[model samples]
Target: MRVLVQRVTSARVTVAGEVVGEITPATQGLLALVGVTHDDDPAKAQRLAEKLWQLRILDGEKSASDIGAPILVVSQFTLYGNTTKGRRPTWNAAAPGAVAEPLVDAFADALRALGAHVQTGAFGADMAVALVNDGPVTVQLEL
Candidate 1:
């Protein structure tokens, strides 16, 4: 599993002109673009979720786990795209939807279980994400 974590003031996802999920501006919050791979297991998803919760990237050097900040989790298989070979990105590293969707859901559920206010985009839907990136801080998480 891989997650692209971004610090955001606020974030939202829209699908077919309809808002699907959002996070209100908190003192600190994370926008997670989550991806699942064929080798990823539930344990890995759980571990990554725990890591995100405790990741110390907030202001005052606080962690999201400390401040009870919200998290917006979006399924983003594109994170595994490989474009090194040619113009078109190859998605061989990404798991197929049948295998990936459940892992994505489990990842979000695990984060929520860790006491985060978790918001999520609809799985497998075309989405438009809008965000006010805080500090322009971003990190790639893998497990």
Candidate 2:
């Protein structure tokens, strides 16, 4: 499991021109782009969720769990795109939707279970994500 975490003031996801999920926090929030691979499991997803919640990348080095921050979760299979071979990228490293979708849901659920307000983009949909990045802070986590 991997997550690209970005601190944001606000974030939203649109699918087919319809808003699917959004988060506008009073202070700061997170836009989590989650990805899964063949070896990833629910345990790894949960662990990554915990790590994201406690990660101290926000203002004043506060964590999302510390500030009661909201999080926007989006499925991002492309994170595993392999471009090492040639001009063309390969998706072989990314888990197929059948295996990934449930794990993505588990990650979000884990965050929610940790008491963070969470929003999610529709899995397997073509989505447009918009966000105002706070401090331009971004972090990448893998488990």
Candidate 3:
């Protein structure tokens, strides 16, 4: 499991010109782009979700666990994209939708279990995401 965590002042997702999810301007919060690989396990997805919830990237060095900040989770299989071969990126490392959708949902559920206010983009849908990246702080997480 992998997650690209970005600290954002605010974030929103739109699908077909309709807003699907959003986060208010919080003092500290995360925009998490989550990905699942073919070998990824449900337990790893759960652990990664929990880790993101508690990740310390906020101002004052407070973790998300300390602040109860909201999270915007998006399914981003592209995190696993491989460009080593040629001009085209190969997505063979990414799990197929049938296997990935459930893990993505499970990851979100795990975040919810941590008491986070989690917003999500539709799986397999074309989405436009907007955000005011706070501190331009971004981290790539794997579990």
Backbone clashes under 3 angstroms, per model: 0, 0, 0
Per-residue lDDT over 54-81 for candidate 1, one digit per residue giving the tens place of the 0 to 100 score: 9999888888899998899999999999
Query: What lDDT score is found at residue 33 in candidate 3?
Result: 95
Query: lDDT ranking from best to worst?
Result: 2, 1, 3
**Model 3 poorest ten-residue lDDT run:** 20-29
What pairs collide in candidate 2?
Answer: none
User: Per-candidate TM vs. native?
Assistant: 0.97, 0.97, 0.96
**Residue 50 CA error for candidate 3 (Å)?**
1.5
Regions of candidate 2 where Cα sits further than 4 Å from its true position: none
Candidate 3 residue lDDT tens string, 1-143 = 88999999999999999989898884668999988888888899889987887788898888788998889999999999999988999999999999999999999899999898898999999999999999999999996
Model 1's TM-score against the true structure: 0.97
Worst 10 residues of 1 by lDDT: 19-28
lDDT of 1: 0.92
The digit string of per-residue lDDT tens for model 2 on 1-143 reads 88999999999999999999998756689999999999999999999999999999988899999999899999999999999998999999999999999999999999999999999999999999999998899889997
Q: What is the lDDT for 98 in model 3?
A: 91
RMSD of 2: 0.9
Displacement of residue 44 (Cα, Å) in model 3 is 0.6
lDDT of each: 0.92, 0.94, 0.90
